[model samples]
Target: MEKVSEKVRQIIQPGEHSYVFSKYLEPIAHVKPGEVVEIYTKDAFENRITSEKDLPSQILGDYLNPQTGPIYIDGAEPGDTLVVHIIDIEPDRDWAVSVMKESFGGLTSTDLTPMLQDPLPEKVWIYKIEDGMVRCNDQLNFPLRPFLGTIGTAPEVEALSALTPFNHGGNMDVPDTKPGNKVYLPVRTEGAFFFTGDAHAGQGDGELCGVALEISARVRLKFELIKNKEIKWPRIESDSEYMVVGSARPMEDAARIAYSELIKWMEEMGWDKFEAYQALTQIGKLHVGNMVDTYYSLVAKIDKKYTKLD
Candidate 1:
């Protein structure tokens, strides 16, 4: 969908140095249960990597994936759910950059994986955004499928990095989070402090590389609080389907968690015991979000039509 510029109830700007999602972080802005907001988020590297000569290894010391706003929503509390509607995602800059991380990706392990092998060389690719597409290169080109790579409500426990996806919805990198989609995040604290960043002009499933077509984006969103719904994981819904998102290590566990959550949610949707399982087995699709983060993410999706059985 083409980016739309409309009125928003509030506008939130990005903060510096603080990239993690935690309940302790103070709320930047507050909104009612149903409100639209325009948020400006920095690129994953906070717009530090502008040139190929600029080493992400050197520039990204700690300020990575800087998100905008832990926006407070009124009437939101623990055990409730925050429903985020993706109204629009517009690239703020004409250029975007992607990186091949030196030591931290699916290819090798650094602090997280802990291996003796040296990290890979940092490779940067700058793309020019034009004609409704981001030109990767002369040989490689694709449409501008921009979406937020990281979005989450603050976690109740310890502060978590914007690099990992958790129950509160951190860096899931799910490609399904585009315009017209609604992501239901479980509320962990009062007001549902939420943040978003890491916009990608284009990315494939299972973001095999650590980096995507990372770009700064002006994201338009609508928020609503689900008063009584208690969700165990992040759930997303589009015009046609419902998706359950789960993040974890070892990859398959993430997949398992997503499908399991889908089944559980389906049970609550008026399906008899095991009926949801039987139905999902025939109509579900597993979408790989990314495998290169601190935790891999998987999304289980089933078309809504399948759920309306006679």
Candidate 2:
């Protein structure tokens, strides 16, 4: 086991696009898995909305979604697979606030009265399990599954907004981010600058509001490179006995994208196409990872025990 210590983490600066790799990725490449590295990340609002204690007329629109790092892996490169195994996520606390009736949230109802810009900058209400259940509103009983809502790097030649998940990963709200899961992201740059931020204490499929129970947390990730196997998008495998195929697009399109990839994967594993399709419709389930991102992503979870892996 590597010694556990807090590294002086930096927050991805505002107005910066295409996080430069040579500087950030080089350092993290040296750390071993099981070694804890504490990262400092900004809230999605990126200080646009201050603490819930006070409300503001307008939030700073520029510095939103400042992810932590484009941390480079030692042997990572384009056409290679960067596998990140999550060891643990220690959120300073287990709770977050959600604002209903906002400009881009799901709780906006036609009949609900709008609150003034001074009604507490949209409170992110959180709850504790004082009685064996995490109590939110009287009716809400949430199961905690803390995850990094945004985790990706810059695309090859452009400054892709952190708001979408392409062949390059970005704000993907796949709930499989819980501990003990490994995510395989395709590398597009020499170092594969990886940054992760926007943590959620607990959330459901399709982060309808484009947010989750927001919180600050520390993540332990083990990084390794799979050389020479080219992949297009992101894939996740977990001890939960499932392999996830993720794609970004409209819901239907995303499903088609993920499903198509699954078919290819099945064939690569030597399975019949007809049987794979049959199994997909019958036993496989499609999960809406996040819909609010510009290009929504759909994830299909395939049970590992039943599928052959090479």
Best candidate (score: TM-score): 1
Task: Report the alpha-carbon TM-score of model 2 versus the true structure.
Answer: 0.78
> Number of clashing pairs, model 1?
1
Candidate 1 lDDT over 10-105, as tens digits, reads 465634535888878777888876566778888888888999888887787755788787788899888899999899899999988988887777
lDDT of 2 by residue, 115-213 (tens): 444332344444653333355777777766777777765577776666556667777777876677778777778777777777767778888765676
Q: State each model's CA lDDT, in order.
A: 0.85, 0.63
Which sections of candidate 2 miss by over 4 Å?
1-36, 47-57, 106-137
Candidate 2: clashing pairs of residues: 25-72, 70-194, 97-124, 97-125
- Model 2 lDDT on a 0 to 1 scale: 0.63
| Candidate 1 Cα lDDT to native | 0.85
The predictions' CA RMSDs to the true structure, in order, are: 1.9, 5.6
Candidate 1, residue 210: Cα displacement in angstroms equals: 0.7
